[model samples]
Target: MIGVSGTLVRGGTSKCWLFDITDVHGRGASLEDVLLAAFGSQDHSQIDGVGGATSTTSKAAIISHSYESGVDIDYTFAQVGVGVNEVEWGSNCGNCGTAVGLYAVQSGLVRPRGEQTTVRMRNTNTGSRIDAVVDTPGGRFTPSGNATIPGVASPGVAVGLEFLDPVGSTTDALLPSGAAVDDFTLSEGAAHATLVDAGAPAALFDAEALGLTGAETVAEFGAALPSLLGLRHRAGVHMGLAAPGGPVSHAVPKFGVVGAPRDYTATDGTRIAAADYDISVRMASMHAPHPAIGLTSTVAVAAAATVQGSTVHAHAKARDGEIRLGTPAGVVSARLVLDGERLTGVRLNRSARVIARADIFVPRAERVPVALP
Candidate 1:
């Protein structure tokens, strides 16, 4: 039996259970079966496992001691959708990165000191250095504070997440195809799209092209899931981001609608009035729904909104350099540093809490092949 210690944490808009890959056994089961057991199959209640039902709560991360100097740990992400059998490992979840640093410190892997502790993590998926800062009171991570972000319902200790060299996370180039935008000819007609690979590969399209106000609620889109998923699948192929009809397991090359803020009702029935944000966004996770948005999508949304020719730019306000976006939950604020046409850096804020850490026990009866159907 292999025993592993794990921590279930909430970071930004997502929650994840973190484990060390070295401690876990059985990579034998197909990703689908593994995810089903990990997240509790057919159970949105997650009565038999740790999954929180919503995509935000259906994530997991594997962390290991880093061999590289100046980096504390290596992070790998796993997206386990509610009913899906597979776990998507194609991209990194920045929200999950927040918990990793704290987990490292709490587990005695790294020493935490002063009020602020900075931990550097190497994202194995993207080969990016993510810097995380936590406020420690009395030499431990403390969540009792007035710190707050717009999206989360309650305020907790604030953790600042900075993605270093995010300009080419998924692909070697910010504009992977060497063009600011790609001209894709759908069955209907040809439409211009932007392909940005920073943090994650993302395909950008105007809201109007899909008959969306860019201000629609989550329900409105859910009602059109068939078409929406089809659009995403087609766009994935169009961008040359994925193979023609290949598995849509890769969450990169995310599809989203960008439009200037207009008065709209949020998923929570709150009014996301035009005055609240400059742009509106709805991002998918593993081709499933997300209660809120993820960090990578937030970066893509901000980058597209700031660019001059994208559809989002039309409704964007001429403000300071940073771009603020409104989502189903609330506003997600981020920054994009532009070095002429090249993207230099991306930054954002997130929250994380350490739930628990203890050895995960694997019974001897399971010592045989961890079988899956």
Candidate 2:
């Protein structure tokens, strides 16, 4: 058996296996094979592995002490396919990024400074730098707090995440297609969409254009997966996020449907009044409705909302400041800083905690050849 030491962390709305770079044995295909074994890929239920069998839970974060000046740690996010043996590293997970600072301090990868510690992280996937501030009392990490975030039942330590210069993460420009609004051609008709790249690339569409109310339950969204995926692929091609006629399975340029806020009941049976939020959004993860909105997508949504003529902009009530977005799980808000038409930065709060520390074992037959560092 091959043993790897790691920690299971719940960051924001996603759970991930966090590993040190030295503990990982391989690279490229070999690395993917190891991850597949560890996460029990090619199985719908992930019954044989540590994975939770869901897109949000089947994630991995590889970290290393950064050699770059001013950066505390380097993080790489991986999306492990639940029913397939594939690991996509095309995009960074803002939820996972929220926990990197705590991981660094806990594992001694970086020393904490005073009562509050700030760790500068460089996301290897997109080469974006994020400043994560975690509360440390007497140079020790603190995991207790009353701050709460949607999708998480209990409150934990509040981690402040600032996505600095968060534009064009995956593409060449903020608007990769050079248009705030573009025509996304579908089989039945065409719809107006906005392809924005802030922390991550995303394709946003007005819910009405797609015959959606933007307040769909997870099951209801799953029922429409085929058509939604088709629209995502078409938007990917139009935004140059995917090559013409190519597969859109890399998971970059996520797809989301947006609508003006309205009174509706959430999946949790909680009433969400229209006046409580600025807009309503529904995003997809691994072809399924995301229980909660993604942190990176939140930045993309805020950026798009600030841009005039974009799909999100039409539904958004205000041009800037705190934008509260209602999702299937609950409400999430982000503070947007815009300089004219340019998005300067985005700030948000997330809670993270170390759930467990254990060794992840891979069977001898499942182990791949270890690459020399």
Candidate 3:
């Protein structure tokens, strides 16, 4: 039996399984099926896999040594849906960036240093350079921390990942289609819509168009699937995404609502004062509410919030550059580059860690088919 190992670690608000692809001989389609059978499904129980039910947990990482300059590791991200057999290799998830550095240090891929170790990562999926810094004390990899993040249960070590040239990681162009924004008139009698693809392609619509407060809670929006689906369909067309023949299936260009920052209770029951945030935004993954926030979408939202002609909040004396956000969990900052009327880039900060390191048992089916010698 071929042995393949994986490590389960928390990066920002999301978790994933990190693997060493170079060590594994057969990690292509056969191995992908094995991973699905092991962790892809939506029963909430996940039964016999490692998935944690939420989109944040249905992820995997394949790490390898890179030949690129200023980069030591190449990280490829995969998003596996629960109860589904397909694995999406679309874009990069910023939450998993922290794990890259920690994993590199633990595996002796990078020399461990005191206090902090900086590792350069080349995101294979997005072709971006992520500068990851991990906490290493006494020349040992130590990740224990007391710093609290909003969505996580307890405090853990902090690893910061900064993505350089974060725009157009997926589609090659910052706007993907060379358009600052695309407007699709809804097929159903809704209203005009604008789709933006700065960080992640997303569709923007007025909260009033859907009888939303623009200040509604996460649960409130999640419960309105039919309406959300309708919007998602319209957004898919505008963003030039493959229509799943229905609504959006792969959670691209996240759907968000922007409003003037006002005093309101968050999902955690914390009172969010208007002065705390420049603008308030909420996004979705498929039809479910994100537990706390998503790093990629956060970048997109912050970028859109600063734009002058989007459905985002219009009265905050919009900033001329990058914007900082206060979410239910804590503060998340992203950089927004505006060239003329086009959004150039939306860079985000994230962290990753290495929880476990060892070899895993690979099933026969997961191994390459053998031709008898």
RMSD of 2: 4.1
- Would you list the clashing residue pairs of candidate 2? none
Cα lDDT of model 2 by residue, 1-373, tens digit: 6787889888898888998988876633366777788888868888878899998999999999889999989999999888887899988898899877778778887788987789899999999889888878787877676668887888877888989889887776889889999987677787888999998889988888788877777777667667777778878887787788998755777888899988878877898899999888999887788888889999999888877789888888883488998898888989987777677889998888888998988654434668999
Q: Whose lDDT is greatest here? A: 2
lDDT of each: 0.71, 0.84, 0.65
Per-residue error at 33 for model 3, in Å?
Answer: 1.1
The better-scoring model by TM-score among 1 and 2 is: 2
| Cα RMSD to the true fold for all candidates | 3.7, 4.1, 4.9
In model 3, the Cα lDDT at residue 318 comes to 61
Identify the runs in model 1 with alpha carbons over 4 angstroms from their true place. Answer: 1-3, 25-36, 41-46, 186-192, 338-341, 358-373
Q: In what order do the candidates fall by TM-score, top score first? A: 2, 1, 3
User: Which candidate ranks first by TM-score, i.e. highest?
Assistant: 2
Off by over 4 Å in 3: 1-3, 27-29, 40-44, 137-140, 176-194, 243-249, 313-322, 326-331, 335-353, 358-373
lDDT tens digits by residue: candidate 1, 133-236: 87777777564445666556666667888877776666676666676666656677665567776677787666666667666677775654556676666667
Better of 1 and 3 by TM-score: 1
Candidate 2: worst-modelled 10 consecutive residues by lDDT: 25-34
Cα RMSD, model 1: 3.7
